[model samples]
Target: MAFGSVVERNVQRPLMRLISMGGAPILQQLHLEERLLRRTSDNWCIVNDGTAPPTIVMGVSGKVSELVEVEPVLRDNVPVVRRFSGGGTVIVDQGTVFVTFICNKTAVTGLQPFPRDIMSWTGQLYDYAFSHRKFGGNAQSITKDRWVHHTSFLWDYDVKNMNYLKNPKRAPEYRLARNHTDFLCRMNEYMPSRSVFTEGLIAALSEHFTIQQTGPETALSHDNDFEPSTKLLSPQDLQDIISSKESSTVQRVPGWPQS
Candidate 1:
């Protein structure tokens, strides 16, 4: 088969590989690096086992008011950061395993735009990971940006637990409190643990793509070398960071019809 044909056969198909990643902040930074890498390399893929220290990450469009319980989260010393991609806010603990695919948009082969081909592709990967289990996974468009497909594996996703965290009545300033309430309440109950899902995704991607399991040594080499531009936040700095972006517009990816 031709190269393109081979890649097309692999799209949404299963592949297995081993990957390890550091804490949540490091993984978030790596996501930024992968975004930059898409501008250059083709054929490269990344699967990160981002099982990290406890942290809360808000999506690019997520309202801080909605995405975090500031007083408690801060008191717990868990860092809250924003990702370049738009999606639902998520909490990453040691139990969560994060992964990402880094390849040139031109090398994406059979997948088309947004929800259709991309969603199918991810669904296949999830299927391979959760193989005989009751866990569930899904994909959605968060933005027009290429190079990354944003997803999460819910290990023990409980409606009551999610509701306790996302209660609208708890925050009057939240914009889509009602929407969040409905979304969490209606979520599936079969969420699997991060490790199980990560293992499955790696296997699926390795079978389908040209898989390369990376270590911290390899991952660090790809790091963006920006200096310590900002100081470790003092209480005032934290307040400023929150205030500066409070009124900013949250970017959203255009949704497409299913394939």
Candidate 2:
């Protein structure tokens, strides 16, 4: 179908708010996502956040003992935060670039508010936005009437930071038992610069919505009422997890040797 028909049939003059949040803590970013999903209504939003300092971010359902090596994390005093969204764990730093999309159910015609559907939609959008160095990965949070889709672009990274994460018992098959360095690639190695990639994303978005550039303050001005379920684990919290017998159970692979 033509772009005109898509606009006419689904959304007429759909407006999207674009906000750039530079170097925010992983917890703050998750809070922002929650606020947008709860307080806003019938609006589309995009947030670009550059992470500062290295921190471990995990899915809402993730368990510390299952996903992280607690000893190094405690020794180095690294922050470990679980987001409100359901996705795998990651160690993000200054080198990670984040883009988030918050949208109403009907913001995009023919787009369903399910995980796979949103992933496929974003996968196509980035294909248009970053032909050279596409987004590194994505995750989703969906509600009855709204959904949030976010992607992280790995511009560069410290290999040492990867050691904080344990090899997850359940991972995508494509990972093929490879270590972090082998599984992931740096965007700077393939694409020009971060600015160029950002420009490309904005240009691609123009094809979908009438975007208005806004500041983070504007997005946060509404009365705050949302409470996030996820929390950042303190050193004490990590120790408690280690001591708890209810920590996630380990599953052995059928052919793998057991300890």
Judged by lDDT, which candidate is best?
A: 2
TM-score per candidate, in order? 0.59, 0.85
Per-residue lDDT tens digits for candidate 2, residues 145-244, read 9999877778888989989999889987777787777787787776778877777777667667888988777877766666777688866677666556
Worst 10 residues of 1 by lDDT: 250-259
Supply the global lDDT for candidate 2: 0.75
The parts of candidate 1 lying over 4 Å away from their true place are: 1-19, 22-39, 43-45, 127-145, 156-196, 223-259
Off by over 4 Å in 2: 1-11, 127-135, 245-259
Residue-by-residue lDDT tens digits, candidate 1, 1-259: 0011224553564322234555535445445444444443433444444445555555555566555555444444556655555555565554344555544444455666565576566665553132223222222322244555545444433332242234434432423445442433211234334455555555556556656565545554544554322122233434443445663342211231111
In each prediction, how many residue pairs overlap at the backbone (N, C-alpha, C within less than 3 A)? 12, 0
